[model samples]
Target: MPSNPTLLDDQPATGAPPSSPSATTIGDLEAGLDRLQSQGPPARRDLVRSLLPVAAVVALLCVWQILSWAGLKRSDLLPGPLTVAASLADAFADGTLQRAVATSLLRGVSGFAIAILIATPLALLLAQVRTLRAALGPLVSGLQVLPSVAWVPAAIIWFGLTDATVYFVVLMGATPSIVNGLLSGIDQIPPQYRSVGTVLGATRLQHTLLITLPAALPAYLGGLKQGWAFSWRSLMAAEIIAVGGSIGFGLGSMLQQGRDLSSMPLVMAAILAILVVGIVIELLVFSPLERRLLRRRGLLTQGAS
Candidate 1:
């Protein structure tokens, strides 16, 4: 047997290169398992994600406090968060902040409502008729890009420092945004949706309202959110210029007065008040709506807030 060299070549040692299924070696299985384990979501990661902003804010406050302790020349200019918080409290206690907030909200919400009423019909007209879209699409886009603040001066000239001026500026800023949002949404609808109603024997108007508008809801919501932002900004800018007119002085006026009086904390508080309003709105209204919509559409995946 030892002498037969031919036997060695014919009998081959390592077994018929393993069956196809055996191609998955232990190392391959281990690597695949490692990949899956790495991808697994952690419970704590969600909690940490929610707290990160709070942590960052705390860090920023610490830095500001340290800077103040170092006796910087601009300490007055860069007041600590606590100082601004105190000023804000005082404003609230005296009804100043409350009055300004109420006045501003009234103007902003009114303008926004009017914008929606106007912008929706306009957007619908453009969306339904190719001719109108071609004629005014660029104009609408241009108006959206133009700063809302720029409208403040024009509004004053037109309305002469009344509540109407504030409303005008807010409308100018918000209307274009709402129209654009709705138009964009309408554009996104599939061609099939238009005919879906026609197949069901709907009249042209009925078809549009039932099929097309329903399909454009996401885009409409986007436009609505954008309109609110525009309205708020425009209202603030108008308030700054139109104070002591027909309306009570607003947050913008408070800021201007703080500046005139050289009250750094007051100025900071006013600025913070503006920011807080935006944050509160997003948290209470916009964020929840967006998240709910996205979650429903399977576009967003996150742990419970």
Candidate 2:
């Protein structure tokens, strides 16, 4: 049958017109989402964030100085910032503090490096093997809670007053942390990730390198940070106890010497040096790396850590 032209014209269009409000609304929604996903905080906000910590430190120093001024009778016991700074300068000029820092950093970094090497593979094995993880998992967690200082006496007995003793202590302190961190990261992975990898015929190594490791990076980094802390603490404990050993004078030994000489400024200087080193490392290395990683993942929000 022939359709009338008016009847055909009266039929409604199947789709919205190109310039319709609904189309425009959908387009606007998409653009908004894109902007939200891509944009971060402004540069001015970042600058303010960078300055905040420095301001806090300055405030703390001011308070410390004021307290020292008020406590004139106990000035020798609680040396002012100036006294500590002067002691640091003197130690630096005489090469004492420099040597101590160098020795400690070298030992801590090297020992931590070795600990990573030993722990990564061990953790991987335990993570992959059900029986091994079930057997050793509790022990690994327990080790994290154990005081690293507890190992000093045993380390000395096993290795005597040698660098080996210090390294052993550091290993004992750091390895468990790394192991636990990696395992925790791996455990947190959704089971579907493994299933996807398996369906794609990925080898075990490929699965780990491409899928598991990247997913677990944040946790692994956290573990590494904790491991470094444990390494530094263990090294200090060993150095303080085994000062006469071949390990040379480290920050802990420097502290011990200050005590032996009954010099409060030197003691405070040593303590400050240790703190500065820890802070410097965190600010220079881990903090930037963490920010970068988290930003890449879109996990770091503006004005947040």
* TM-scores for every candidate against the unseen true structure: 0.80, 0.86
List clashing residue pairs in candidate 2: none
Residue 237 in candidate 2 has what lDDT?
86
The residue-by-residue lDDT of candidate 2 on 210-250, one tens digit each, is 99988888889889999999999999888888879577899
lDDT of each: 0.83, 0.88
Off by over 4 Å in 1: 1-45, 301-305
What TM value does model 2 have? Answer: 0.86
> Which ranges in model 2 have alpha carbons more than 4 Å from their true place?
1-45
Top candidate by TM-score = 2
Q: Which candidate should be chosen as best, given lDDT against the real structure?
A: 2
User: Considering summed lDDT, which 10 consecutive residues are worst modelled in model 2?
Assistant: 1-10
